[model samples]
Target: MSQDSLDDAYANATYIPGAAEYPPRWTKEARAFRDNLRENDQIIEDFPYGEGAREVFDLMMPETPAMGLAVFVHGGYWLRFDKSVWSHLAAGLLARGWAVAMPSYDLCPSVRIRDITRQITLAVTEAAAHVAGPILLAGHSAGGHLVARMACENVLPTNIANRLKHVMPISPLSDLRPLMQTAMNDDFNMDEAAAMAESPIFKKPLSVPVTVWVGEDERPAFLDQAMWLAEAWECGHVVEQGKHHFDVIDGLTDPDSLLTQMLIGGDIA
Candidate 1:
């Protein structure tokens, strides 16, 4: 396919109606949610995991003692967004009696994708120090790709890896070689070797369980990406009907949602 076609395939907002509206809505809801949690003394704002300004993460404590830790990484193609914009997403896991950690990492052009992966590793390690029991990871889009990376052998330390209960990568870019052809690659600065090395599809999955989740209404590229990871890792895959890239993550807001269940359930063994 031509470069233009590749861009079209990976382009999400172009096909999703009113895509521009989602961010602002998310920002508003997330802000309100965080404020309420803050008022109730249920959150720890700007918990630092690294010295970088963007390396801080917010740890949201549940109403009762946390059963375990669930870390969520947000997606903006690894070029946009921060942990603050996604504060609301912690609701589902927190409601499920788990502490949720939302982390912000240095974006591309400022740091490479590999660097961002390491930043998330630091965030997870730091968050784990505060919470106990099992560790569950879930990320959306680019964030999905990051979490999936955690499942790769040697990506995470043995101590953390041993406690991993599950990993759910939603609409992940498992094979990033195609992305190198996209216009966004300019910021990624990834050559063939870098893309291959970072791609979860090309890496071996650790013994921990994984689940590749995608939206049936997502662009074909994302659907293909999800399938590639599931097939490569030989893990569970779910394509939610009527859901698109933007709304596919909405399930994370509901404690009873299937996405939430699978993420914290750790039943995919």
Candidate 2:
């Protein structure tokens, strides 16, 4: 495909005018909620998994005894965002008594995408150490790709992998090769080999089942991505109607949302 066509396919943010404004809102809400939690001593803030400035995590302890561990990884296309902006997204999981941990990894351009996979693997393992029982991974966009990568990267041991109940990658980029043609690739510096190495689509079959979700109104490529990964991994998928790329992930912050329910392994009935 021509470079223009390819870039258009990946231009998710462009589809949503004023998408730039979302981050500020996330920052404001996340900071306020985190402060409330801190005032009540309800959170473990800036807990480190690595030495880098971005390698820390924020743990939001559920009010009740935690049933399982749930890690929410943020999405900035492997380049932006930190755990702090996503603290508020823990509400749904927290309400279910699931201990929620959000980890920040070194961004691309600073570190290759492969390095991010390692950092996230370390973060998840570290978070899991502090909580007991099976763990569920729910990530958005790039975060979705990361959680999916964690599932098949040979990073988790059978013991830990066995305890994994679900792997959900919401609006994830399962195939990274196409990204090489997009402007996002400018910061990402993805060559053919690196894309092959990083795309979850090329990874071995997962250690656990994966559930994919994408906004029904998202770009065609995104919908294809969800279906492609599901087919590649032999998993299932849901096209969230009336949702776009950014808002599609709003479900993670709502405990009653289907996305949250999927992670908790419970049914609406």
Candidate 3:
């Protein structure tokens, strides 16, 4: 592929038809889901981790005694989507007796990716403070990359860090340097140095196990990133056949999914 083609390859919109529709639908569905949760007083809304407007998160408490927290970070290539669009995705985790915390963060153009990474560290840390048990960290897309970084680097303080039981980065862009050649870089403004610093593939092996799951039908770049990171970190990779970038995240919302089972400490095979 030419440089331009390689750059286009990184943009999911280029490969997934009707990609623009997902966000709006996600917004609508997630809003309704949150509203329903709030109506029954099943959720804790607007719990702030930072002063910024987007630094807040919604905590969906499990109906029974809680299992643990599944801290999920929303992804928009570090540009779009807030935590609002992802509230319902926590249903699977919630059903499995896990309290789910979905956090929002400042997006790009207003903040750098590094800043977003830090915000998630703060978000996860804040969520940990409230739920003082094992933390199952999971994120999708760019959010996936952030959680992976948290695994490699010591994002949380020692006390909280030890509570992080597992990390799941679904279809993560673990190698961020490639984005420098893509149009998304316009908003990201990720120079070579920053990309290298942020890419978890370049970081040290994580002490916590990271189970990476990807869609078989996703672009090769996405596939390569997951496989590369799993190999580099000596972790597990679960490739679901016939899934694309968009539907690949469906696992997060399904209790019986291999991906969700991985996060909740169940069987994947």
Candidate 4:
């Protein structure tokens, strides 16, 4: 489909209602996950990004110099949640002797989406300097948007973009035009121009590897976004998880899961 036609279809698309309340049950599970992080894990909270802006990121390091680092960005549709909620994701990477970094960016409406993307760039660039080895990027939801943006060489410093061995955007929001038509945009404050600018599918593909994964049970829009990114980048792999949006991330914590094997570079069946 033409970009314009896609935009038009997205503009007219119906907005699917998300969970009405914060998934309290998931939040509780996340808390337990956080408590279980290795004792040696280090959290560098509220690191400065730009003037008057800070991002929180936690680091989980193994006993030896890591073979590679995995940086994870948390998802909340660019408007809600924080890094504390995703420390659980670090546990599995740490066990594999991969250092992990989870960064929290300022949410939208209060801060424009572009600025939020910039903040993530800053966080990752800074985190990269401190780690000992190559870096791999991963994120869930809005975080997937940010990390995908980093794959674009022009969007990030040349050094940082080139340093990425791979990028895994889980349950990503690859196209933002659909969001402009939804109530979610009320806080996102995105117009046509902003949507096009932030949409990864509209950007030129990076040479770096990008793997896009989405839950089989997710909304069609979500699944389409993943497919769009995979085709646009032409360097991404799409994995279908027999799970829903929220539960799909749980795969990150299970080393035996396909998601983990892909992230850590295990043989894919």
The top-ranked prediction according to TM-score is 1
Task: Tell me each candidate's TM-score.
Answer: 0.98, 0.96, 0.95, 0.86
- Candidate RMSDs in order: 1.7, 1.3, 1.5, 4.2
* Cα displacement (Å) at residue 267, model 3: 3.4
lDDT of 1 by residue, 165-230 (tens): 999999998988998998999999999999999999999899988989999999999999999999
lDDT of 4 at 44: 49
Order candidates by TM-score, high to low. 1, 2, 3, 4
The sequence of per-residue lDDT tens digits that candidate 4 reaches over residues 100-213 is 887777887888899888888888887888786778888988888888988876887877777788899988888888777666677888899999999998888678778998
Q: Write the per-residue lDDT of candidate 2 for residues 1-269, one digit (tens) a residue.
A: 98899889877879987798888888888899899888978899889999998898998888889999999988988988888787888888998889999998999788899999899998998999899988999899999999998899577756677789999999999999989988878889999999999888898855677889899999999998888899888887989899998888787778898888887889973
Model 3 local distance difference test score: 0.86
Q: Highest lDDT: which candidate?
A: 1
Weakest ten-residue segment in model 2 by summed lDDT: 153-162
Please state the error at residue 179 of candidate 3 in Å.
1.1
What is the per-residue lDDT of model 3 for residues 158-247, given as tens digits with 9 covering 90 to 100? 776787789989889898888887777889888999999899988885577789988999998989999988998989898999898888
The alpha-carbon root-mean-square deviation between model 1 and the true structure, to one decimal in Å, is: 1.7
**In model 4, what are the clashing residue pairs, if there are any?**
none
Global lDDT for candidate 1?
0.93
Q: What range of 10 consecutive residues in model 1 has the weakest lDDT sum?
A: 260-269
Model 3 scores a TM of 0.95
**What TM-score does prediction 4 earn?**
0.86
Q: Which stretches of candidate 2 lie over 4 Å from their true place?
A: none
